[model samples]
Target: MTWRARLLALDGLTPQLGDADRLVWTTLADAPDGAELVFLGLDDGRPCFAAIPAAGDAAPRLANPQLWGLMARLPAADLALYGGARSLIDWHARHRFCAQCGGDTRLAKGGWQRDCGACGAQHFPRTDPVTIMLVEYRGRLLLGRGLGWGEGRYSALAGFVEPGESLEEAVAREVLEETGVTVPSATVRYIASQPWPFPSQLMIGCHVRASNDAITLDTTELADARWFSREDVATALAGKGPFTAPPQQAIAHHLLHWWLNQPATA
Candidate 1:
C-alpha cells in the first residue's frame, strides 16, 4: 500500500480549513511547487508535512482562518500540531539570513535547522523559556494586570528567563520585580508547563509562597497588583467576579486552577 504524504498549508499565519471547519492539509500532489515544507513525522504510516504557502493566496475551496480562533475549535491533537507548525514556520521566516557572515541560509534537518551558504554557521529553532508563577501569601493569591490589558483582567506574574538564571530564580525574581513580593527559593515549586506559540515560548508554571503581603507595584511592568482571597479566585475561575483570570488556553489558568484546589499548606 502506497501512503500519500499530507501538508498543512498556511497562508501567512492563517491555516486552511475545509467546508466542515476542519483543517484541510493538502496532499503532496495538491501542494504548490514552491511552498516551503517541513516534515512533521508519520501519522498512521502516512508522512505528514507542514507548509507555508509561497504566495499569500488562499485556495478557493478552503477558508483561511487565523490560528488563535482555531485553538478552542480544533481537537487537542490538532491544536498541538498547529502550535508546533507555527513555531517552526515563524523561526524559518526570521532566520533566513545568517548572522555570522550576512549570507543566505537554507532549511536543513527537515526544517529543524538552517545551514548558511557563505559561512559554516548552523542555526536551530529557538524556544524562549518563560517563568509564570502563582504567588500566594497567607490565604491570598497575587494577581496583576499589565498595562493596556484593560480593567478587570489579571493574571499570575510572568517574565522571560534571563541568560544565566534557573527557572526557580526566574520565578522568584519576576514576582519580586513586578509586585514587590518576595518568594523564597524553598517555597517555589514546579506545577505544570505549556507550550505557548505566540511566536515561540515554553511557559514554566510554578507555585510560589510569598514571604510578605504588602505590594509595591512596578508601574512600568504592571498597572496594578493586589492579593485576592481564595473565594475571589474561585469566583473568577467559575466565570464570575469583577476580575478575569487568563483564559483556558494559557498556563496561568491551569496554575490558578491547581492552586485553588490544593489543601491549605501552613
Candidate 2:
C-alpha cells in the first residue's frame, strides 16, 4: 500500500487527451442535468471528464448516498468529469450573490467564473484548504474517531486552515486542538494532496512528529483519539484488526500507508 504512484485517476489523463478544451466546452454545453462532470486537464484546451445521467430503464445507481464510498470504483472519466462538474456547479450554487455588494452574479468563463452585476466583481470557485496530518510519536501514529464518520471508522486529524496561518502552522495547531498532542514545527513533512469534493475541500496531507503520547480528545470534534503502531495499522488495513483503514481513495489512507511501509531512512 505504499505510494507507488499508480496512475491516479486524474493525473494519467492530463497528457493524452488531444484538443481537450474544445471537447470540454462542447461537453459542458450539452451536459445533462444529472450528469457528473469533473475537470480533467487541458489536452490542447481545457479538458473535462463527463458522466452521463441514467439512461432509460437504467436505475440511478450513482446517485445513491450509500454508494458514496464507491467513488474510486467509478471510471476515471466519470470521476474526473463528476468531480469537476460538481465543484463548478457547487461554486455557482453558493456564489449567487456578490460578497462585496450582495449583488447578483452571472456565470461566465465556460461555467468557471461569475461576474457581479452591481459591484463589478468577479467570483470564482473556492477550494477550502484543509490540513490532514498523521501525528507520529515514538512508534505510533494518531487517529481520531470523527463524530460525523460511521462507527468503528477512524481518520487522521484534520481541520480547516484558519486565516493568517501557514500549512505547517495549521498542522501543528490542528493536531494540538483536536487531540491535545503538540506537534513539533520542524518535523512536519508534506506527503500528498487530493481534491476532496464531499463538498469542496482540498486536502493537504502531512506527517508530523508528536511531542507527547497523552491524548485529550477535543470532545466537540472527536469522539476518541488514540495511537496505533505500524503493525496495528497494518492489520487494520488488512481487515483483521478491531479498527479499519480509511477509505482507499482518501489521501489519509495514502499518507498512513506511506508511513507504515517506508523503511527507516538515514
Candidate 3:
C-alpha cells in the first residue's frame, strides 16, 4: 500500500501487487532518503516495516477512491497489515510534539510510543472506542444514511464512546442522541467488534430491541432513518433492492449478516 499522508484512515491509498498477487513492500535499507520508517512486526522471521513519505498529505478525499476499489481483491491478512501500518504511522505523524508540555517528542518503542525530551512525557497510540449498533423495533432493523453516503446507501448507527461511559450506556445514549430511538441499556446485546482503521477506532458492535418504531432524525448525524424489514435487509445485502449495503470491510455489513442468520424467534 502507498500513501503520501497517513493521518486519516480513509485517506487516499493504492495497493501495489506484484508477482503472485501479494502486497509489495520495501525494506528500511531500500527506503527513500526522506522517508520515515516504522517497525511493523515480524512476518515469517523477517521484520516488516512501513516506509512513509516525510511530507505527508494533510487532506484526504473519497472521490473515486482506489483503496476502496481494491479492498475486496487483497487477501484479508494483507488488508489487516495495511490497516495496522496506517494507524501506527498516522499516530506518529499526528503526535510529533507533546500535548502536555509543548515539548518535542521522538519516536520510541519501534513506533509504538513517543517520548517528550523536554517534559519526560510518554505518548502512546490512541485506539478510540466507538459503539455501532443495529437498532431493532419489533422484527425490523433500524438503518440510516449519513449525508456523505452514496444515494440509497444505509448502515448501522454509530457514535464515539464518551469518557466515563460503559459500552452499553454509550450504545443507548448514541442511539437516542442521533435518532431519538430510546434503547434500554439493559437490552443492548454485545456482538462481535472490528478495529476500524479510520484513524484507529475499535468499533464495538451491539444490538438491542426497541419497543417503539418512530424515528426523529438528528439531521447533523443522519440524513434519514427508518426501520427496515427483514426482507428489505436481505434485498439490500444482495445488492438489488430497498437500499445499498455498507462496504464489506465495515462492521455494519457483518452486523446485517449476523442479524439475518439468527433464529426466527430471536
Overall lDDT per candidate, in order of appearance: 0.81, 0.69, 0.79
For 1-266, candidate 3 gives per-residue lDDT tens digits of: 33322221222234576556557765455665665567777765667777654433344424546667666666788788877877777677778889999899888887888999999999999999999999988789999888777889889999999999999999988888888889899999999998876678999999988767778889998899988989999998999989999888888999999999986444
**How far is 197's C-alpha from truth in model 3 (Å)?**
0.9
The lDDT, on a scale of 0 to 1, for candidate 1 is 0.81
What TM-score, computed on C-alpha atoms, does each candidate reach? 0.89, 0.76, 0.90
172, model 3: CA deviation in Å? 0.7
lDDT: worst 10-residue window of model 2: 4-13
Residue-level lDDT tens digits of model 2 in 1-266: 23211111221112112242211233354555554343334544435443322321122322444445445555566555555655555556566789999998776665667899997999888899999998888888899988766677787899999999999999999888888889887898999898876557899999888889888878998988888888888888888876777877678888878997776422
Question: How far does residue 33 in candidate 2 sit from its true spot (Å)?
Answer: 8.7
Clashing pairs in 3: 5-57
- Give the Cα RMSD of candidate 3: 4.5
